[model samples]
Target: MESSLLLIQLLNGLQLGILLFLLSAGLTLTFGIMDFVNLAHGSLYMLGAFLCASLTLYSGSFVLAVLLALPLTALAGFALEKIVVRHLYERNHLDHVLATFGLILCLDTLAHLIWGPAGIAIPLPDTLNGQVELLTGVVVPTFRLLIIGTGLLAALGLYLLVNHTRIGMLIRAGASNRTMVGALGVDISTLFSGVFALGAALAGLAGMLVAPIAEASIGMGNDIIITTFVVIIIGGIGSMKGAFLAALLIGLIDTLGRSFLDDLFKLLMSTEAAETAAPAVSAMLVYLLMAAVLAVRPQGLFPPLSR
Candidate 1:
């Protein structure tokens, strides 16, 4: 395998992992603390992309669009929690799944109505649309680098927010034992609402960042939502640290497998056989890893430490 190609693939894998981390960070919090299973989380992602796309077009500034879209996505999350999700919190996971599944359809249709059926493409300025060379013969898109940086910053911010601040203390407490936190005079309802909104914003950030690379289409979140769930599951359900590391691992595995598996397979079998099997196996790599992890450590590679 060529070294340059390998490096490029490695970077691509890192980018994918960053996106997964962005989506999963907030989700793990919501899932771990509220015990809420929100299938509609992906809808927030789609909503963010579309919102950013529209705002970018109107303002002629991609950066400004993202800034504006974040609060809107958060507000959307807050409203959903207040109007719908809060009611279902007392119900079981099955109910959460069914309700959120219905919510997916509702949000999708709403997006379709407002944005129309076609995907909206976001335009980047020349400064970001160009390419940069990390080294001789190793050039990558400038926007991709921006994505990596933005995601890492977001992750760092989340770490500080969850570990250093007072709310972080509350969040950690809530994750460990929400009932105890509630009994201690903390307003569980407010805490849950804030968490859900935060999760939505994070998911939205993922969507906004990706909109330029891939047009923001209706139901775009449907596919990614599944992968995001796999990520959180592979990481411990409520562990931020688990989610970050696991996201990167899955990202590298999926990206590298797709890029290099065919070459490896060719060495082991007939070219035609390798060509066919490579695609199938590459697609299944993430699932296979998840299965292996589940078999050995059902709690995940980095289960959250108990308080």
Candidate 2:
């Protein structure tokens, strides 16, 4: 019974990690390549979830909503870059933070105005609402398995896009030296827009996938975005590979710790004491890991080769 329960928790952790990777990948990429500190990235994620939820409700089709939301999210991202983010690119990080923070406030206000103050629940599609039996007497949700697959596929697609494509080469060059890349007759502005849009799309994808599982709510972005930051920091600020691995590590640690820490503590201490300490310890695991990593390497688990 314990072993089967452990397996389920492990899969849950993997699903969470995958979602974090989806969100963190874009953040690390945008920050790494453009040096743009977008506090509003989470706002974009919230908007994506709202859009998807609304679309699914109205259209009565989750697939259609997802297909539509991706392009819409990308377009919204492009517009944001072209209008507001472009001006902040030449500014300092502090300036970037301030501007984007204001944007976040604006987005939250707009979301409340549009969607009201309540959270919306996205129903799982009929096909994905079932469970899959993995081993004898061990069952996992189909949607969670899909999430794991989606995350792996997104990681692979991102790898190919960044490494095997022309724009990707430009992204690499830009990360190393933006001025030189621009001097080589490359249109840096257009490239930045593309990168930003792509990042937004990835965040949106993460938001959409999570909506059915965890209901879409205002300020949800702010909550999860902090964890995503932890993932990127632990993984490496600008390394997608680092983000992927770090997210999985953090996710598994968090999930499993929350599940079993009290049990471990119970063996060593009184039941009441274990209960009191478990939640705090579980919450601190990621930050503790981050601090330890920084104390040793200081550059994260896998710092980008370029930056």
Candidate 3:
């Protein structure tokens, strides 16, 4: 039973890691290249889940809702960049933080007005609603496995887009030195806008995937965005490789810590004391991990080559 529980927790961690990767992939790109601090990124995530929920109900197919919501989320991000984000780009990081926080409030209020204050639950098709046993005794949800699969495919696609394509070359160049890329006639503004939209889409994808389990509601992105920041920070601000691995590491540590920390503590101390301390320590595990990482490698585990 313990082994089975461990396997299940492992899968849970992977699912969460994949979701974080989806979010941090875009965020790291935007942060690395555009140097923009977007506190409202979670708003995009919330929007994606709500959009998927609405579309799923309207279209009667979970898959189709995802397809439809993705582009719409991207468009929303594009419009946001052109209208509001672009204006703040020239400002300092503090201004970026303040403005984006305001944007978060605005976006959350808008979501509340449109989707109502209640959380919206997403439905899955039969194929994705069942459970499967990957190991002798460990059963996992089909939807969670699908999320992991989709996130892996997305990571691969992003890898190809960033490393192999011409646009990717331009992206790297811009990240290293935007002024030089702009001087070379690369149309930096448009590139950054596209990057921002891509980030939004990735964030939205995370939301859509999570909604079936967590539901879609106003300010849904608020808490997760903090974790997302930790991911990018631990992975390195501009490093996709860092983001991917760090997210997985953090996810595993978080899940396993929350699941079994008390047991480990009980081995060391009394059961009551262990129970009292476990929850608080488990909650701090990620931050503690972050602090440890900073102490050892301030630049992160895998900083971008340019950095």
Candidate 4:
């Protein structure tokens, strides 16, 4: 029974890790390449979920809603870059932070105005509403499996884009040296806008995909944004490979810790003590890990090359 439970928890961790990756990949890319501090990126994610939910309801088709939401989210991202973000690029990090923070407030207010203060629940398609059995009769939700699959696919695509494509090369170059890339005749402004849009699109997709399982709520992005920051920090900022690995590691650690920490504590302490301590301790695991990483490797697990 214990082993079976452990397996289920591990699967849960994998699912969570993949979702984090989907959200963190774009964040790392945008920050790494454009050197933009976009706290409002999470708003893009919220927008995706809200748009998907609304469109799904209006169109009466889950697939159609998702397909439509992607482009819309990308366009929103582009407009944001053109209108708000471009001005901040020449400013200092503090200014960028302040501007993006303000944007988050505005986006949240707009979302509430459009979608209402109460959160909306995204209904899963009937086909993905149930569980599927894995080996040894362990069952997991189909929606979770779908999230994991989509996240992994996104990571793979991102890996290829960054390491193989022309724009990706420019992005990496920009990350290492923006002035040099600009001097080399690459259109830096266009590149930044493109990367920002791409990041927003990825965040949107994550929001849309996870909405059915997690539920869409006001300030939902706040929690995930923090998690995404931890993922990127632990994985090494600007390193997609690091983000992928760190995201999975954090996910597994968090999920398994939440599921089994009480049992582990019970082995060493009274039941009541274990119960009281388990939640607090489990919640601290990721932050503790982050602190440990920062203490030992301030540059992150896989620091990008400095130009």
Candidate 5:
């Protein structure tokens, strides 16, 4: 039974990990291909949640809300790329960070103004609200399973899109040498817009999926943005494959660490010490994993070509 409980927790970790990968995959691609550091990526996620919530309330359908929000969010991304992000591309990382940080502030304020300060609760359709019994007799929420399935599908789709399409070839070329791609007469601006839009759409999809589970609120993106950054760093900047693996690893470590770290600590230390240390230690596990990875690989698990 205890082992079964552990298995359930592992599945939960995987679910969370896959969602993180969906968000991080787009983020890493935007950075890798366009060299654009967008801290406001989380804003797109927030927008998706809000849009889905509003649309679901109005349309009375989660599927329709998601469908509408995807393109809208993609447009929002394209607008940001054209209106604000384009100027920051040639600037240093610090400038990009500042500009994107400002965008975050603007977005959060706008979300608050539009959605009001209160958090919105997304209602899960009855069909997706229950629990399912797995092979080991462990019951897990159906909504979580849906999230896991959607995330995996998105990851697989992105893999094929980036590795097997002409656009994918262009993205690869841009990642390795943006200047050279432009020199070769590629319309780099169009590529940038497409990449940014795709990234935003992914973030929005993640937000919409998670909204039924987590509250949609102003400033909700802040914590998630930090988590996404950790996923990218651990996975390797600009590497979608790395992001997927690292996100899953981090998710499993975080979930399992939270579940079992206290017990493990009690075995090695006093109960008081274990209580004091467990939370902090569990929170640090992903960072520790990242540090370990960097110590060995330096650049990341899969560094994109520097030039």
Candidate 6:
């Protein structure tokens, strides 16, 4: 039974890590390649969840709602870049941070005014509402399995796009040296816009996917965005491979810590003492890990090779 419980928690950690990957993928790209500091990325995630939930509720079809949300979020991303983000690309990081921070405040307020203060719950599709027995007696939710599959697929697709394609060549060059790419006659503005849109769409997709589990709320983005940032940092900025690995590691450490830390502590201390110290220790585990990693390798586990 303990083994089964451990396996279940591991799966849970993987699911959480996968969601972080979706969010951090875009964030790392934008910050690593474009050098843009987008503090409002979390707002995009929150907005995507709310929009997807609203559409799913109205359309009465979960599949269609997800399909619809992707493009809609992409469009929203494009519009945001064209209108506001583009202006900050050439500016310093401080300016980018301030402008995007204002954006967060505005977007959150707008969400509250539009959707009210209550959270929205998305009903699970019939196809994914059941649990699957992976072994003789161990069971897992179909939705969580879907999330794992979807995240892996996205990672594979992103790998191919970044490594095998012509545009990807340009993106790589741009990441290494933006001026050289412009000198090569590539349309830098359009490329940046596309990258920004792609990032937004990824974040949105993550939000939508997790909505059924966490519910759609105005401040949902803030809750997970910090974790996403941690994933990016631990993985190394601008390194997708690092992001993927680091996310899983952080997830496992976090989930397992929260679940088992108290029990482990009780073996060494009184139950009351263990309970009192476990929560704080577990909560700080990731940050402690991050600091340890940074102290050893300041650039992170897998910083971009180009850098």
* TM-score of model number 5: 0.97
lDDT of 1: 0.94
Per-model TM-score on C-alpha atoms: 0.98, 0.98, 0.98, 0.97, 0.97, 0.98
Candidate 3 regions off by >4 Å? none
Point out the worst 10-residue segment of candidate 3 by lDDT. 23-32
Which RMSD values do the candidates have, in order?
Answer: 1.1, 1.0, 0.9, 1.2, 1.3, 1.0
Task: Please give, for residues 248-273, the per-residue lDDT of candidate 6 as tens digits.
Answer: 99989999999999999999999999
Q: List per-prediction Cα lDDT, in the order shown.
A: 0.94, 0.91, 0.94, 0.89, 0.90, 0.90
Ranked candidates, highest lDDT first: 1, 3, 2, 6, 5, 4
Residue pairs with colliding backbones in model 6 are none
State candidate 1's TM-score.
0.98
- Mind giving the per-residue lDDT tens digits that candidate 1 earns over 142-163? 9999999999999999999989
lDDT string for model 3 (1-307, tens) is 9999998999999999999999898889888889889899999999999999999999999999999999999999999999999998789999999999999999999999999999999988999999998988888988989999999999999999999999999998988999999999889899999999999999999999999999999888999999989988899888999999999999999999999999999999999999999999999999999999999999998988887
- Per residue, candidate 5 scores C-alpha lDDT tens digits across 19-70 of 7887898799889988878899899999999999999999999888999999
What is the TM-score of candidate 2? 0.98
- Distance (Å) between predicted and true CA of 171, model 2? 1.2
Assess candidate 4 and give its TM-score to the true structure: 0.97
- What value of lDDT does candidate 3 attain over all alpha carbons? 0.94
Task: Compute the lDDT of residue 164 as modeled in candidate 6.
Answer: 98
- Give a tens-digit lDDT track for model 2, residues 28-146: 88999899888888988898899999999999988899899998998999999999999998899999999999999998999999999998998878899999999987999899998
